[model samples]
Target: MRNPLAAGAATGVLVFFVCFYTKLLNPTSLPAEPANQVARSINAEDTGNNRMHANANAHISWQCLSESDLRDSINSTENVIVVMPAKAAGTSLKTFAKSCNPNTTENLQTLLSKNDAFNLLTKSWDMPGVYASHFWVPTALSQLLRSISRHTLVVYIHREETSRFTSAALHVLTQWCAHGPPKAQKNFFDKVENNNHKCHVREKKLVEILKDRPQEMQMGTIELLTCETYSSIEEYAPNMLFVDYKRANVLQNLLAERYCPKMTNHSHHIGKGAEKVFVQLQNGGTEVSLSEWLEKKSSYLEWTLGLNDKASCLVQTRTMEDNLSTCDGSFIHAQAVLNY
Candidate 1:
């Protein structure tokens, strides 16, 4: 009779070999990666076209870009530039990267390890045709971008402050603060045990950090609290493409358009049905939306309202002449509120 034990052993060996080869062939059949992790190139033709546009001074094609092309451009050239607000929801650095390439978990981990905005700048200054995102985009980055690129396109994103703050706080608690150095201990929380109080403290600290003159201004916890501040980026970078950060598919479409506009038209959220909403606490309203709460505290609104009494000769100044003309001799009440 056949040896039952020998037969069983032979079958087990064959199964193990098959399983090992399957794993070697298909790596992505493994577990999921972290949020915003790049996977692989979704489109190749678009990627090649974007690389050509990015490499030279040609017009951008509206097509889906591939991860390999993006990676090659980044690895090879250092001429192009991209700016993104940190902690933005619609399009983040990870989202942008994913549009071109599917980065692995290991790759993302390596990037996070070198998350310093300044360091990345210094290291990549010599490269060409690479558009990178610096979280804060410090003075060094601004100077570098201004120096190299022939045609620079600035994309600015606007979102309701409260939503961004909430997302940012959670990101800090979960990502940076959780694994950050001992110095970041005060920012992290173990759980939502007292999230209300924790949120308040975090907000206060953020506001304090963002406090200062315009030149010294920087995004902190509270800066993202104002819808106006995000939109007001135009005042700083006039040529910037201000996009509503709340729109879905914005980041992907933007990248696709930048690389290959014809094949993949990136429709801006500008005229899209409803605009982004921010609810303010009605001076004495009991229940106020988070967006409204942020508006009340944002420096952008504070500065605008504060300038009303000063009567500066600014270009877009709403002078008494404009207001009086609109009144047209009607019973101009001393106080008629115009909410727009």
Candidate 2:
């Protein structure tokens, strides 16, 4: 029972602590305040530099493409349209447009088209203005390149999926539960004969009914946009200008690179999405600190970042600090990438 190895390990630990204390007790050997500050500063600088290197060197993620060089063309164009996924960075694209040409608000209609709202694109009741919104696939607008004028620039925005999909599932669950469960009723179908002939089919399983719900009701229309067969934009639409979807300010950066470099900071950012219940369960009973969460989920997170970097998305101005991966916002520069 008395293992020398265990005893030796304990003794080594105690001796190491004693030596550490000895060094701490001797003030003369400790670093001076100025030297310590310098060292700390150096360490901070090194950390920042290292992160920059990692971000740049990352094989999956795309680097921030400059926007300052493209301001003129973006403002001059009259029929430019931005087609973004629901949670894509469409907001930033509009903001960038405004910044590019503040006076063009009146004349901007000729230049840009958004698909979302009246107030966002047009000032008056009716005007040929920019349209921006979450237009699900298979819509008439989805065939923009073929239907519309060839001169019209259509920017298709996208984000990394793994995290977005999980968040979307949670969003659906929360929305469904918010309506409260359907009334529980006993089956009277026993009395009815050949009920299947009629349009009204009685149901006992509420949960099963929900499970059978249409894909769009449970998951956003964007799910349909995901192609299992094709990999790149070249396969889908060759004419579309593909931007990296992960830049903090997807639209802003895109515009900045195309229009206004002066304000191109790529400033918007968002936080990671909700952790899956299964993951939490797997780490059950463990302390499961934030650090551990980040460590375990780095690879998944990086996938989004990589997608963000590679796929071109219109970055929006409204910064979503809570969930960055969902939007075209910048992410907090966590110094190192997570291994998992």
Winner by TM-score: 2
TM-score for each model: 0.33, 0.37
Worst 10 residues of 1 by lDDT: 330-339
Give per-candidate clash totals. 25, 40
- Best candidate, lDDT: 2
Per-residue CA lDDT of candidate 1, range 232-332, in tens? 22122222233334532444454554453443544434232221212223344343333344445555633532312222222111222233234322111
lDDT of 2 by residue, 1-340 (tens): 8999999999999999998998889867765679789888877754311212222221222222234322333454554555554445545665656666553453222222444333534554433333333435433333344344444445445554444433443343333333432344224111222222211112223223323432323322223232210112222332333343555254555456544567766566556543321112232433332233434554665253342332211121112122333323333211112233
Scored against the true structure, residue 179 in model 1 reaches a CA lDDT of 45
Q: Candidate 2, 237: how far from true, in Å? A: 8.3
Cα lDDT, model 2, residue 211: 36
Residue 46 of model 2: what lDDT? Answer: 44
Instruction: Name the lDDT of candidate 1.
Output: 0.35
